[model samples]
Target: MSKSTSLLAAVALVVTGGVALADDTKVGILMDITGPIASFIPPLQNAANLAVNQANEQGGLLDGKAIAVFGDTTGSAQGAVDAAGKLVNIENVPIIMGSLMSGTTIAAAEAVAIPAGVVQISPTATSPAITDIEDNDLMYRIVPSDNYQGEVLAKMVLEAGNKEVAVTYVNNDYGVGIGQTFIEAYKAAGGKITSAVKHEEKKDSYRSELATLSQAGGSALVVIAYAGDSGGKIVKQSIEGGLFTNFIGTDGLRDEALINDIGAEALATSFFSSPTSPADNPNQGTLHELYNAAYGEGADKAFVDQTYDATFLTLLAIQKAGSTDRAAMAAALRSVASAPGEKVGPGEWAKARKLLMDGKDIDYDGAGGSYDFDKNGDVSGYIGKFVVDGNSYKQTEVMQ
Candidate 1:
């Protein structure tokens, strides 16, 4: 070959490689990295990033690579609106996975993603309101609604022999959703709530609310709030004031951030409910093994499994659609998510890619367990009880 010919051929190769890299698809990560639930974002972010990397390793969706474009929800509705606008308008992501909080997820979906024709899969937005929203079916969640977790929590409380309790919830969709459900279930289950108060977030003190809540003098104080923001404050102030010694918290309060605030010793007598992987699901073990290898102790991390599942399903839908067209991607989501297909277990991206390439159907049973996304884009899953033992938090029970 002539020298010029060889040079031209090399130039062609370089240009083609550049085009391939440029064709890499962007998957928006709309998580509360800087907002209220900031403490929960790292591990959850790690889980989503891991899924994207796995897809890239398996040649990504349709020969193009996958990448995650992050946006911090800042733990506010306006923050989510702005973050989602950036993702849909500027980054041009076909789909997004996050805004882990319910209010942020709803705000972003209604104000940004739905109208803009982008799909959003929430990893941890468990509010029951999500099930009833007119989202054009663009919003989906990997975690079960608060309706399930709340009832189970009530049962757990009753099982512990508590007859009546006082409750305080953050003034937000998540807190209200779970709080209302807990109230109904607790009452129907023959338990009484002596008091229920709604408080705003970012407040420096919750002593007034705590004082009122504890006035009833019950066995426990149920705190329905996030651990990073008001939830942590409530727990600390509640303890400092020497009000309610025993406490029960929901998923929002289950975090290392809370422990940092109140210390492990302070949380010893308390327990909280959060989503979990079923022990019978071997895929959970497999995915956790891989997750922990890279990011230490990722197995029990809140929403880690749900985040992985959400990201994985989004990429799979993209591949199945063969294009980034919004309608096509949405159409392909449920079909690929449920039914008679080859079993693809968690952390099995390469395997899933191979099956799709061969024109075979696949049924993905992820670390969060098998998915059958209902018409409302919701899933039914398990919630676990988290209790502090010494310096660490351990899940003591996996409620069905």
Candidate 2:
């Protein structure tokens, strides 16, 4: 029932949602489209576009068609507040999918989204700090927090047989949260860290920091930073300066740009970690089919699944609310996510709408996996170990 049901439901939704859409409704997109983590946003933005397009084809929300109006966060907190302010006050969107980075997501939630009562869902912000934000249930994220990813990452590093390593993290919520967690987990797991150093992003050079980290001569270096900013530069400088050869990083460094910038030969012995779906998740294959048909084969990329799921859930919540009312939409978010009525997944938009119209509840299972949101609006998921193979990095292991 899992695979076949998902496939048939997907095909039906695709066919129904492919027709010309009529009315127009807007959903906000807050991202780092061209900032520090810029490389990650393209596929994510495409995913958002794909989901909204599919929704419109499925007859949109209520009598209005869904649209993704974007605002760049510049990959910073203040940038997020500015972008979110425009989205809430000007665009007046009921829901926003954005602030891919953790700091920006927090900023948007506290300073803009929550106060405005606009629901915000992040596709990639995974800091542990997000677990206790007082958003009054207005903020949500599709990815598991670093609280989960960090421990899983630590386990991966230890299991890889690297007992002693040096650590460097960018100075931000994403880095600090994951770094501390990895440190504690690594130490507890009988691994020894040379020293934990903090690095700032957008720096032209990290040679000094790399020198300090590799002072004691370590077998591996763990870096938790954005690829476009300090992480890629650090890896490149480390290799050229002969400070360190083997390197590791988190999702922030898991990008094609990193490999291109630093070259594959340098990262051949290194690895990075990021969140991924469970092997048994029933939605991924169908999502690939829909993605390939719309954007061409191989168009699907990182965060595409979560981006699609988050976008779908956002619009569905507004549909469930039956209005653009912010509070009502926020209240409906969990109902659309968890179970109680008809089971829904990607390409099941029409089915879901019918169920809702019939006064039945619906559970939205999507590309990433089944989302059973905890009280904090977080979910349990898997993390993958990515290693460089020739010119790009690919998932080598996925751990829950």
Most lDDT-accurate candidate: 1
Error of 1 at 55 (Å): 1.1
Query: For candidate 2, what is the TM-score?
Result: 0.92
Q: Can you give the TM-score per candidate against the true fold? A: 0.93, 0.92
Poorly placed runs, candidate 2 (over 4 Å): 1-23, 298-300
Name model 1 segments beyond 4 Å from true: 1-20
C-alpha-based local distance difference test score of model 1:
0.83
lDDT of 2 by residue, 218-252 (tens): 68999999888888888889988888888989989
User: lDDT per residue, candidate 1, 14-129, as tens digits?
Assistant: 11112336678877888776667766766776788778878887677676788677777777899889989998888788988887889999999999999998889888899899
Model 1 alpha-carbon miss at residue 193, Å: 1.2
lDDT of each: 0.83, 0.81
Candidate 2: worst-modelled 10 consecutive residues by lDDT = 8-17
